[model samples]
Target chain A: MEHLDALENQSIYILREAYKKFKKLAMLWSIGKDSTVLLWLARKAFFGHCPIPLVHIDTSYKIPAMIAFRDQLAREWSLRLIVGQNTAALADGMGPERGRLTCCTALKTEGLQLLMAERGFTGLILGIRRDEEGTRAKERYFSPRDKHFEWNYKDQPPELWDQFKTDFDADTHIRIHPLLHWTEIDVWEYIRREAIPIIDLYFAKDGERYRSLGCWPCTGRVKSNAATVEEIIAELRATNTSERAGRAQDHEDTYAMQKLRAKGYM
Target chain B: MATDIATPRASSNIVIVGHVDHGKSTLVGRLFYDTDSLPEGRYAAVARVCEETGKPFEFAFLLDALEEERDQGITIDTARARFHTARRDYVLIDAPGHKEFLKNMVSGAAAADAALLLIDAAEGVQEQSRRHGYLLHLLGIRQVVVVINKMDLVGYRQRAFADVRRAYLDFLAALGVHPQAVVPVSAREGDNIAAASARMPWYDGPTVVEALDAFAARPSREHLPLRFPVQDVYKFDHRRIIAGRVEAGAIAEGDTILFTPSGHRGVVKSIERWHPSRTGPARAGESIGITLTEQLFIERGEVISHLADAPRAGAELRANLFWLGDRHLAPGRPYVLKLATQEVPCAAAGVSGVINTATLEHVAAHEVAKNEVATVTLALKTPVAYDCFTDIVETGRFVLVDGYDVAGGGIVLPPVEDDYTI
Candidate 1:
């Protein structure tokens, strides 16, 4: 777990930096393994207590178990959990049938945008890793989003050494990514080492398991018998299957994630 | 079961830098292809795109993922790829070599443990070849393998390779850098890449992959003096924990630590890790918390180190830096200087000279423009603990923020003193 140790240190450093730099900050927790591990790191960073609020954009299509797990941990850890949803869009019949990208933009990106506007939060901590997707690789640790929450990835600020772009204009918000350097295997390895509690949806139930969690309607499962964390790690090491192979949204188009992210989808 | 006990493979961050269109991306893509590191269907997917578009298969296509970059056929940002050799794993950072993308290059080079300075043998040494070499020196990347690429364009001639190598070596020598080796490669032809080139029988050296595998990893600085820059102080229900990463050396329970700038001292009562399984001494690169015996008036942006070998605290110091902002860096204008966790209002008291990165010539200047390196004397509003860039990279470097942007970055000059009169 030496590699995990290094990754943990770097992540904790970034988390602390975010906490110290931004006054009104919140962490996005998808109730998935990566965000759960990020939550654990926040607790470790703030000495067993995370003062930052955890924001969850509930799409109303999430698997039932994800909500259950989220609430259980929030209650157990006494976390300041904040759930945001695009109620108007959901009521207007916004779903995957109306096009995956449109549905995601309304439910996820617009939902988070409304949440930010209402709460006036300047910084958002996310559990995104570069190895997960092509667009994610181009992201800086502290990425800026304009007033409309549009990501200008083309003309990004210069980020050299450990000097991140923490300072932003009044209307600009920064997305803090602590797990950008870690890989899928690194996450699983750290989860095992720290004994972090994760939702069982990742474990194989009936010859299949969710490699990447999302809305129940769109998320698919990969064939695997990796029932334990250690088994999952071994499978990840040997398998060439993409981590998001089971996430249907990513496979919707070649640049689906990029298009979603450009509009500020976490 | 034995795999559980086996140590993790040592990993190094390697950056590839060269002039624009020098095949930096192609070289990186070739490495991934030669090592079979591309994920399932990734290569095939890109190849399929090429076929559908009626374009020839390009290794660079694998990395230029962005729409604009693909259309322009230029890398605008640093692309990272993980490649594993029999000896170790590498995080290969492919830096854009365009002059305007110098910031991206710096961002990539800053995290590198070693570097591959690529130069086209046909073009000989270009402006970026020298600029990148100068940057690698500034970033403290001592281990470098100069890659003279495009041997095919130069007919794989030993004389062409030697000419570029000799010129680049001279350039590096002027910057006080001694690279580990100079390698010949043709990323397009796959010569001296994964395997030695039969075309260049006269040249005998390690291939690009072999050179990378042979590059030495940075030694752990655990024996050095402890430098724990306080990131924050947390009070979780009366159990106050001072949180920070151990940048250098180690810290143990009962160790007397001193906070710089504030000049507060206390004893470490205990080391706290979130996982109950972790206990005992904390070594370098560990981000842990510690409960102090006494609640001293300590805050973030202070360096906590052993009292015996404490870091120098000063208000005025000399530094070497490179400016990347659109506006020129001039004296008398106060900017935020952030070093480690500390941020203070600072201004350039004096600009001794600005060195043209390409030519390595010192020129008298009142302001440092974009892509220019300079030595300046900074006047800080508050004293901060720091070391020379050569002594300790963690505490030695800083960024100058102007109006909510990082305008410039630099390293502290050695022999910290209070008497920095302009």
Candidate 2:
């Protein structure tokens, strides 16, 4: 469909924007359908070769299949994969048992933060969509983060038309979300149309499927029998459930995601 | 309601706005729900959050999942959701409609292609509805499709829809917006949203979906000249990369581009995406990295482009402004001016005359309150690559920041009259 092509072109355009705007850049790969699609788009934006580093936060608690899939794609796609982790926190025994927010902060945010410092990265590309959560709604396509990685939610640059604010002050690194305008269904339909590779968790097995991927300890499965991509599309054509319903950290409080994101948690 | 328009190029972003409880969030929620765009398990995430926060679980979760929004039953920030008709992709921005969150509304409206102005059928055109319409006009959002919501609440009465439509048209006319069409529907009852409502068969206009699907992509002022707002100058490993979107027109390798405000001239050497080794020619709406053939220290917010059609470099610009700050604006006060990626210290050169947005009449000796639109003069300490808003909107738009916060938005007016000295 032309709409799909248009969305794809828009995403490729934004990806090209980020690549142009940032010098020491990296792309986040969650091993999910969205970021995987982002990875594929990045390759196309750069003419079949990903010039930026592929960053996958090794929370150390991710599902085993996710880690396997990550490595497999890294090899097949010739990706510059950089696995980051909160080694100190993980060594200190930070787990979901402590708390969902704390766990996510240490494993996800802290992991990325430490990686940025150690690697001297100034820009991060995420596959976050505005429709995924309310706090994400406040995000700019070219959003700037403070030195401390704090997001000033109340104070945002005016993004009129497509002219996004890309320049920033010293020590003020930015995060670019090229897929901020995409939705959950759009990602899948693109996957089906483009035939991008996805992890096994997304497809239902034994009448249960993991709709959203996260730490194995905290993620839950929902009822579904859509084993193939076509069946999944058909099922998605009729369901009302949110894509992130099974994730734990988003459920801790009404503003749980907001609070985490305000402190720079993805 | 289904009238998908064919789009061959990049799709435009459209935001839907109205008063709180007037179905701003509900309309977006319904759009996602009906399109089945809501991802799997997303509802359960909200349900779990609702169970934790003791909030009622419903489709509003699709928009207001933030704790503050849920607690207040209000939208505090601008939320974006996507929908695709057979013709084009639409980015639906659900803006907060409450008076307290007018700034959010302004930000949302700033990014839209066309606006769906929602009016409560029973309420019959309120103040915020008119205010939003006026704000949309000030922001230069030309296409408007009015939706008279809550028809079910009014028993699908043609009389109620007609009254609201009539009142809305008069208000919009006062604000200088002649909307393309006005449709009546019930967002709550799922009437005339994605499907035609049997109840409103007497109404001969397009439904919300049809209006959106049928709308054409408005072309920018690309043909007039070229304007590129520099977001930043990337200096990594000593390789200079001037990065930003081509706000209008296109750029090719070896084209002489001038950085405005800075008054620096350079030749285009190469355009790259993320790496130094890769390069190409960049076009409008696409962000590509550029390496100058002749390197100088160029910072963000400076407009870089072909020297042949370079925009005027100036410190002072006469402009139309939407004031969102609580404090009053006056001449001689310095606020932040952001053009593309450039943020510079700037002073309001003259109060000019504050005009009433609703009436479009100039008023003398008055302070602009929050949510007021006025014509003002801004004088920057440093030069910027800019053009008059009427001539080219790319370089003409800017945002004012005070103490690290964006205070208001601005559109460049015709160059200041000949008599002014900074």
Candidate 3:
């Protein structure tokens, strides 16, 4: 719990810094455990109120329960939720049947990019932990993207100590990650300690559970008997499987995630 | 490892630094392997790639995640790995040792509670061995363990280990760093890593893991004077709350606090939190909000300190810094100096000297070149609250930003009236 406390303090500090630095800032809520915890931290950072809006990219392939859970929490917590979609691409018959990468780019990455451009959002708060994936490990707390939303991982700015690069050039959008230092276990532990609400899909039912949540067509379930949060934590401690094992896009190729991230995929 | 029964152990961040190809990543990977820290299927997946590529399984491969780094067989950035011992858990930060990646090294070193300065026994002390030691001292990491790796190359001889240890010790002594221990190991052969090596009969000391577990945790800054740098002020509905992480000491309701650079003072009306479970004083490391009794015009980049022992405010500062920018840090050129939460436009008013990290010798310089360490006096546009780096690290350390990128980092020297010699 002490470790969780430290992680919480650090995350809250980052959240406060993001809020103070950017004028046009919004948080991306995936309706997953990570983003839900991020939403909770935002509330904690602002003291029972979240002034920034929450942006969710709806691919229309999400499980029905996820949208219901998102709306219920938004209403209960008084959240200003903004739902976006690439309706044009969706109507153009874009789905997993058409290459997963292309489908994700059009419906998810392009959707978010279009929404950001239309809303003139300069910064976005994301809930990405380094231990979740290899590419995420290379990210800075305040990562910058070009006007075209491309990530140049090779030449990232040097971030030393608590002094992050908050100033960016014109037409540059920054991705703010408060959970970069946390591990997957740290996330679950913090959730338990804070008693933050999460979707029930995480808990096992019919001898299977969702370790990571994404679009319904691409995300798969892992076999587990973790019926409670406590059981899930125990399973996580005992298992050597990667947290993103069920995320199909990551396993498409060795560099699938990296390529997607370079193209501004969240 | 049940969630309800497990008690969280104390965790420390340890950085691994040395010259490029000094086996920093291999040693880190071996640590994880010996400690069983690698997650399920990770090692298997890496091994599968090795088999498919017709290459031998390398411990360093565990860390080199990027395609370029893997193909080039070098660590390009700081990669973090988690390991646990009976005593504590450690976040091992494997920093690239190449001179070009010095910025990445600093990024990793700045957050470390302890450090492992690696040196090849066969090669003895090298340029980066000294450079990294100097950086560790500058970054305020007092708990260091000099790791003499690749003993297999030296035939596991005690003489080679002793010579390297002596050389590295002399270098560390020049920079005022006293290492906790000097360990000898072969990261490739797995000797003296997790278990003591029978190969080195003449050398009897704790293994690398034991040395790590022996490192003392950094003492808490609770008893120190309160210094909370205001991050932002939020108005939730009608109640105005000043938010920031308490860098040192503690703050409670009714405590009178003073904001620096602005010279405003107010009493803490109440400690605020979204969850009502926390109702007491907020200590160091806790990010919380407090409502002030008097409505003061306090903004971001202001330090909130206890009125009794307020931090000193000064416009002129003397500092020792390590430059990382491609452009030379010259006098009269303005740069943004960010310390704690404050960022002020500052210029190099005077340059005393620059130290050649390779030789540990002082050289006269009008400007600090890239990857050089120097002592200089800065003139700030406005006064800001600060303390000596030795006294309070949070208020003393700073980074210089050039053209929106972090160019250099330094610590404030103790205030001197006339003398400006390092």
Candidate 4:
């Protein structure tokens, strides 16, 4: 319980800082467990109201249930939703078949880039956790993205104490990761503790469940009998597979995530 | 969904610091491997990568995730990994010790509650060995365990272990850092990490894991006086909510609060929360919103506390700063000083007592360069509320923003006429 409190407080602090710092800020909502928790934290920080707008990049390949869940929650919570899609790329037939990395860059990263450009959001809040991937382990809480939406991972600014790089070039957008310090278990545990509603895809059905949700074609389900959140927590505790093991884009190459992230793929 | 996880384990963040090629990452990898903390197939995955590249397998590769870092054979940034023991969970932060990556090291060290300072037994005490120790003290990491690594290189001799341990301990004592324990081990060979080593019968103190397990988590600041730096004021509807995190102490309805620097006092009308049923006093480490009886002209950077124990307000502050900017920190150059939520344009009034961390020598200089430590007096454009770092850390620590980047971080010191060591 104490551990949860610390994580929750730190996240809430980051959320409030983003709100206080950026005038034109938005949060990326993937309708995944991590983003759902981030949405919950935003409400907690603003006293039951999410002040920042929520941006959802529609790859058009997300599970139907995920889209349904997103709309339902947005309406229920009175959240301002901004959906972005790369129609040009989609019309040109950009997909996993073209190549997972290329597809992610086009549909996901480029989609987000277009939305950010159109909406003119100076700061974006994401729910990326360090424990999820090796490349993510080197991320700072307040990461900066260039005007071209490129993550300059090679020469990242130093962040110490609770002080972050809030000051940035007007053309650059900052990526605020409130849950960067959290692990996979911490996310599931917080979802359980807060009783936050989640999509049904994560729960096991017929001895299989999607451990990580992404584009449907690229995401695979793991064999598990864990049906409830409690059982999922137990399963995570006993499992050794990485959280993104089921996501095919990461396995496309050794440094695939690093490459994709550097190009601004969340 | 349920309420919480089963058996909520305590998590401690421990940063590993040492000179370059001192086996910081190797020790972390070995610790994870010996404790069964690595995910299944992670070892095999690294082994496969090495095989594919036709290179020998190294424990450090498990953490040096970047291809460039692997190719360069050095960690460019701090990498964190999760491991667990029976007592608690650990986030081992592998911080680079190269001087070029000092900012990266400071970033890693600042978040850690405890630290493990590694020293190569074969190399004895090097420059970074002392420099990292000084930095640990400056960062206020009180709980440290010194690990003398590469015992196998010296044939596990007690003399070599004693030599490095003695030199490093003497240097730390001057900085007022009393490490928890100094354990001798070989991270590459996995000696005295998780298990006791038969190679060193002369050492019976504790293994690296045991030393880490002995560390106690710092207590929360709930008992201290209230210090809430107002982050912002939001009026989503008709009600104006003052939102901020309670850095210390707790606040409830009907509590009298004083906003420092402005000297405005108000009564707490109500403590606002998201969940109605979870209503109570907002304690330290909680982000909360509240309504005041009077609508004062309160803005961000106002430190709210009980009127009796409010923080000191001044425009001129004495601080010990560590410069990490590409440009030198000299007088007459304006920089943005961010303390708590306060951001004010400030200038270095004077630079004195500049210490080269590598050599631990005081050089008479008018400016500080990158990766150098110095005691500086800053002149702020406006008065801000703060306490000495010894009194309250959240209010005292600050960072200097040059142009659009955070250039330096430092802790506030008490104003004294004579120079003194902390």
Fnat of every candidate, listed in order: 0.58, 0.38, 0.69, 0.71
lDDT of each: 0.88, 0.78, 0.88, 0.90
Interface RMSD of 2: 6.1
Whole-model lDDT, model 4:
0.90
- lDDT pick, better of 3 and 4: 4
What is the C-alpha lDDT profile of model 4 across B1-422, one tens digit per residue?
Answer: 12235657778999999999999989999999999889987898889888888889888989999888888778889999999887778999999978789889999999999999999999988888888888888888899999999999999999999988988888888788899899999999999999999999999999999999999987688888899999999898888999898998889999999998999999999998785325689888888888999888999999999988899999998998889999999999999999988999999999977998766789999999998889999999999999888888888899999999999999999977655555
TM-score result, candidate 3: 0.98
Residue A3 lDDT (model 3) = 73
Model 3, A178-229: lDDT tens digits are: 9999887888877877789999999999999999999999999999999888
Off by over 4 Å in 4: B1-5, B276-278
- Model 4 deviation from the true structure expressed as Cα RMSD, one decimal place: 1.8
Query: Candidate 2 on A1-266: residue-level lDDT in tens?
Result: 14465466567667766776678899999998889999988875665678889999999999999999999999998899999999999889999999999999889998999999999888899999876777887788878889999988766665554545566787888888988877776777778777788998988989999888989998999899999887777776677676787887887865788899988987
Tens-digit lDDT string for candidate 2 (B263-355):
778888876664222236555665566787876887666777677877887778787787888787767777888776666799987777776
- Tens digits of per-residue lDDT for model 3, B1-422: 32333555558999999999899989998999998888887898778767866789988878777877877788888878788876778999989999888998888888899999999998888888888888888888899998999999999989989989988898788777888888899999999888999999887778899999998887888899999998988877898989999999999999988899788989999988877435699989889999988899888889998888888899988999999999999999989999999989999999888999879889987999999999989999999899888789899989999987999999999879545433
Please give each candidate's TM-score.
0.97, 0.78, 0.98, 0.98
Winning candidate number (DockQ): 3
What are the per-residue Cα lDDT tens digits for candidate 4 across A73-135? Answer: 999999999999999999999989999999999999999998888888999999999998888
Question: DockQ for each candidate?
Answer: 0.60, 0.30, 0.70, 0.65
Of 1 and 2, the candidate ranking higher by DockQ: 1
| Candidate 3 clash pair list | A240-B40
Candidate 4 — which pairs collide?
Answer: A193-B3
